[model samples]
Target: MVTAFDEALTCLKDEKIRITPQRIAILEFLTEVQTHPTAEEVYQAIEKRFPGISVATVYNNLKRFTELGFLKEMNYASASSRYDFSLKPHYHVICESCGKVADFYYPKLDDVEVAAAQLTNYTVKSHRLEIYGICPNCQQVEGE
Candidate 1:
């Protein structure tokens, strides 16, 4: 299977999107970090190696990646937006107290899409579910 990095780069080349060293670094970061990180977090991590790299670079490329379907932008009412690199269909589980995000998968939920399509005039092309609650680590700390 083509790696996420390969697929994204291929898409960019096929679409005539300009590829830059900073963008490549950002893509590498996202592919390796695995954590769903905000733009600021990405900037902080990458700027040391590329001191000239600005947060705007991170934000702009992140926006472009999402527009190209290379990444998924998530909103948690955070001051910054988080980006997910995993392209597979899945749901998000966000910790209410800690602001941590993790993936949640349940194949049965696919049925909901069909039901939604049946009940509404609009076509249901995709779906996402976000669950909020205290995470295990936070619960442990709070219990202490």
Candidate 2:
């Protein structure tokens, strides 16, 4: 089976981008992580394995991956930019207390783009939906 990592490598190869161990480690880390981590978080997680890996290397690889459409870069005004590897159609629920992000699949929202284009007569290139609320963990902590 063609894994996501393999596909990512193929994309880089197609773009004539040189693949290195650091880049591979960065991609592997992103693939394994469920949370949307910032550039600093990614660097911290992988630095243990690659002692000499610089934060700039992580940031640059992430930026290149985002540019190549292998990953999505999520920027929030209140928090640092986070990276997501899932390319499937989904929305995010953000924890207002801890700034945690979780993905939820909602097929119905796919039609929103069509509806928006019809209603506004504007070309809708894409859309993002984020629901913010205190997560269950935070609520439990508050109850205690």
Candidate 3:
């Protein structure tokens, strides 16, 4: 059985990108974290293990991973951009109250893209959709 980690590593190998320490730690963090963190958060998590790794290193590796189709970059308004490694078809739900991000998958949206392409008679390469609302924790806190 091929795990997500295995698939990611395989992609790196296929892309001929060097498997450096920083890249390993970065990929590990992205594979382990579901929170979708910025490069700063990624650096903070791995800095103890990689004392010499810089935030710039994290950003550069992330950019390479994205270019190689191993991940996606999400820009949340004015905040530092976060990286997503879910590596599947889905959209994002952003919490307005606490700035949390979560994945949401809707298979029907695939057809929406086809419909759009037919209507415009133009090729639709891709799309991004983010739904913002108060998250459950925030709602519960306000209820209390």
For TM-score, the strongest prediction is: 2
Clashing pairs in 2: none
Q: Of the candidates numbered 1 and 2, which has the greater TM-score value?
A: 2
Best-to-worst order by lDDT is 2, 1, 3
TM values, all candidates:
0.91, 0.94, 0.88
The per-prediction CA RMSD against the true structure, in angstroms, equals 1.5, 1.2, 1.8
What is the per-residue lDDT of model 1 for residues 32-88, given as tens digits with 9 covering 90 to 100? 996799999899989988999888888989999999998999987756679999988
**Model 1, C-alpha of 87: deviation from truth (Å):** 1.8
Candidate 3 wrongly placed segments (more than 4 Å): 141-144
lDDT per residue for candidate 2 within 1-144, as digits (tens), equals: 998889999999999999888898899999999899999999999999999999998988999999999899998755689899998888999888888889998898899999999999999999999999989999999999
* Ranking 1 against 3 by TM-score, winner: 1
Candidate 1 residue runs with Cα over 4 Å from true position: none
Sequence-dependent TM-score of model 2: 0.94
For candidate 3, the clash count comes to 0
Q: lDDT for model 1, on a 0 to 1 scale?
A: 0.89
lDDT per residue as tens, model 3, 1-144: 987778878988887877887788888899999898888889999999999988889888888888888788898883788889887888999988877889989987889889989999989999888999989999999899
What local lDDT score does residue 96 receive in model 1, on the 0 to 100 scale?
A: 80
